[model samples]
Structure formats: structure tokens, C-alpha cells
Target: MRLFLVIFAVIIISGCDDSNSKPSTKLSEQQSSSLLTIKDESVIPETEFSIVFTPNNEVEIIDAYIEGVDMYMGRIPLFFSRTNKQLQYIASGMVGVCSKNEMVWRIYLHYRKNGTQEGKIATLNFVVTNT
Candidate 1:
């Protein structure tokens, strides 16, 4: 009777552990679909450029870079709320003007969550006219 009771207790504890374990399979599926999509028109020189982030949610934006240059690395306020739903112009501070006549600037959007990279990086290319 003592042997049977010990075996039953071990089985019960193991079952509890299994229930507490995180579901890796489900988490992977969600992570694979997590992506950032920038839906804004191209930026023109001498004119203010407004970038809009769609489907704004709880995604933590690590940084926003333009043409390999850090625009809002740590100085500017980077937090975005869902109520706004748009990152307006002049909000991200000033960006350097393009010197070339026809320059193709690439905007990189980096995102993360809980200090871990959520595998979300979006790139948008825009031309900067000399005008």
C-alpha cells in the first residue's frame, strides 16, 4: 500500500508540472506571424514627411532610423499610443536633408518586447529630391 501511494503522488506532481509549462508550439505560431508594416507615402525634400504606423498596438518600438542614421535613438520620446494611431510629422524631431540630387533613403523600423527582439523589422525606401 505504501509503494502504491508514493507512485500515485509522483504521478500527480508530474501532471501539475506539465500543466504549468508554457506552450512553446502555440507561442512559436504567434511569433512567426508578428510583423511590422509601415503604410506611409514617400518623403520629399524640403517638405515635411509624415510616417504613419498602422494597426498600432502594444508593440515596443526599439528605435527608428533613417538612411543608416539614428534619428530618434534615445533623445526623442518614442512611445506611441493606440489612440493616436499615427506618428505625425515633427514628432520624431529633425532628420538630415539629402545632399544628392536623387537620393534613396531607407527608413528602418526596429521593434522589440520585454527586452527581447520580436523578430520585427520593417524597411521603407523613399526618394529625396534636390528641390
Candidate 2:
């Protein structure tokens, strides 16, 4: 009886440990999938993001105006391009909508070529990562 009880206890502890770790694994996976990586400020359809500057030529984002609570543009910029331009912002302060490791955000991209303005506001779902 004593041996049986000890085995049962060990099994219970192991089961609990496994259960607790499952959520963490799932969360990490979700986070990884949602992370957004901006390469050279280019927005592509799947992997990279790019801004459509002209019908034939597309340039990377160089600036952005994030919408605020009252639909106002944020004063400070959150993201930038290598050109040292304001290219993105965390509109809602990175909470709620961006609380989860994988979240969605409403963002704006500002890019231009020559004297033509060609960026627009858009919504993107990205996984927030430290890297």
C-alpha cells in the first residue's frame, strides 16, 4: 500500500508539471508567430512589408502617424527606418490589443518618393518580440 501511494504521488506531481508547462509552450509558439520583423522598413505581403510608392516602384516606410485614443496622431514616434525617419508607432501604447504575445495593431506607414506622397494607414497583426 505504501509503495502504491508513493507511485501515485509521483505520477500526480509529474502530471501537474506537464500541465503547467503546456500553456507556456503554447504561448511561446503564439508569440513567435505574431512577432513582426521590419526589414529595412520594407513591407511585403507575407514575410516583408513594403509601401507602394508608385504603380511600378515601391519604397520602404520612412515615417508614420499612429492614431491615438480620440483618433489623434501620436506626438512621439515608435518605429523608424534606417533613413532615420519615423516609420511606425504603437498607437494604443502597446496594451490590450497588444497585450498578448501575439496581437494586432492599427498602424500607419509614411513613405514617399521624389515629391509624391504614397503611404497609408493600415492594420497589422504581429507578434511582439524583444529582438
Q: Which ten residues in a row have the lowest lDDT in candidate 1?
A: 16-25
Candidate 2 segments whose C-alpha is farther than 4 A from its true place: 1-62, 65-76, 83-103, 121-123, 127-131
Tens digit of per-residue lDDT, candidate 2, span 27-128: 123223221233333221112233211112334546653232322222223354342233332221221121122222234444444355754333333332
TM-score of 1: 0.44
- Find the candidate with the highest lDDT and give its number: 1
Model 1 over residues 30-118: C-alpha lDDT tens digits? 34444332332444332343444442345566676554122212111223334343432212312234323444445555665545555
lDDT of each: 0.38, 0.29
Cα-based RMSD of candidate 1: 23.5
TM-score of 2: 0.26
The residue pairs that clash in candidate 2, if any, are 34-126, 34-127, 35-127, 42-49, 43-49, 43-50, 44-48, 44-49, 44-50, 63-86
